[model samples]
Each structure stands twice: as C-alpha cells, then as structure tokens.
Target: MDYKLIDNTEGKQYEYHIDGVIAKIEYIRAKDKIYLTHTEVPKELEGQGVASALVKDVLNDIEKKELTLIPMCPFVASYIKRHPDWKKLVLKGINIA
Candidate 1:
C-alpha cells in the first residue's frame, strides 16, 4: 500500500489519510526539537502497517529538517528500536526503550 504522510503543523500532528480515516502522530515542538507524544490509527485501519509507514515518514522528515526527536510515544519509540538508523535523530539524553 502507498501511504501518504503530511505534517499538519496547525494540528500539531502528522497525519495519514487512508480509506477516509486518519492515522496520526501527535507531537509538541520546542525550539529545534519535537516530542512525539502519541500515535493513533483507527481501529479499522490497525495492523495494516499504517503506523509503521507514518513513523518512517515522520522520522525521515525529522532527519531532512535537521530536527531532534524526543519520542515520548511508545509506538514511535518501538519503531526507533527496530530501525536503529533513526537513533541518530533522537535528542541527546533521551533513550528509546
């Protein structure tokens, strides 16, 4: 499946629209860092890799924008653990478990 990810800055989230439903990652931005605090995929859309794709794009955007990541969301943290290369974008003093 082709997933399209967009940063909805006004909403403080990154959203993915699929089948008219939205899967989003909520965040709080401070200076050059962004704290990813929550991730939600509609129950009907769960287990379809939507969350993983959203995180991948979000991490890539963080990298491209040269922003530090503080993954406070368990889902995002778990994604980072599986994709070690994204660890470099994490904020200093923060650990993903």
Candidate 2:
C-alpha cells in the first residue's frame, strides 16, 4: 500500500495505490483557510479505510503548515465534527452558508 498527497493546483488530494490500482482520491483547497471539498474511493477500495487515511494525511499537512481549515465537503465536515481535536485548526470567520 502506498499513499501520497498531491496538490492539483486548485487544492490538494490524497492518492493511494494498492496492488497497482489507484484506489482513492480526495480534493482539498486552501484559501483564506483550507477546505477539503471532495473525496472518492473506488468501490474496490471501500471499507479499506483509504478515505480516512487520505483525510488524515491532508489534515496533517494542514497542521504542519499552520493553516486553518474549513471542511466544505460533507464527508470532511463530518470528519471534522467527529474529531474535536482538529477544531482548533478550523478557520475563523468562514462563511459556508
């Protein structure tokens, strides 16, 4: 299993390769703050925790950069909601509505 985070200009994404298959992809962005916008893992990669791994990897980069985040993606929002430890990293005064 190989996991890597790549920034595709508009945002960052986590890419995972397993058994020579590209298994997962996640979209992320950093504007006034970082925003994780979308995520998808191939059906074969479901239940393998690939999405979680990608999210965690992106979050780690956010922390390392000392950047705040606004999780706009539903999955990312739910992930942040569940992980209170990352709340402090959320951007201040963000308007998601």
Clash count of each predicted structure: 0, 0
lDDT per residue as tens, model 1, 1-97: 7787889999999999888899999999999999999999999998889999999999999889899999999999999999998999998878787
Candidate 2 Cα deviation (angstroms), residue 2: 7.0
Task: Give the per-residue Cα lDDT of candidate 2 at 42.
Answer: 77
Q: What 10-residue stretch in candidate 1 is worst by lDDT? A: 88-97
**lDDT tens per residue, model 2, 26-82:** 544545566666778778878978887777777887798787887777776677777
TM-score of decoy 1: 0.96
lDDT of 2 at 66: 84
Best by TM-score: 1
* After superposition, candidate 2 runs with Cα above 4 Å error: 8-12, 23-32, 93-97
Q: After the best TM-score superposition of candidate 2, give how far the Cα of residue 8 lies from its true spot, in angstroms.
A: 4.2
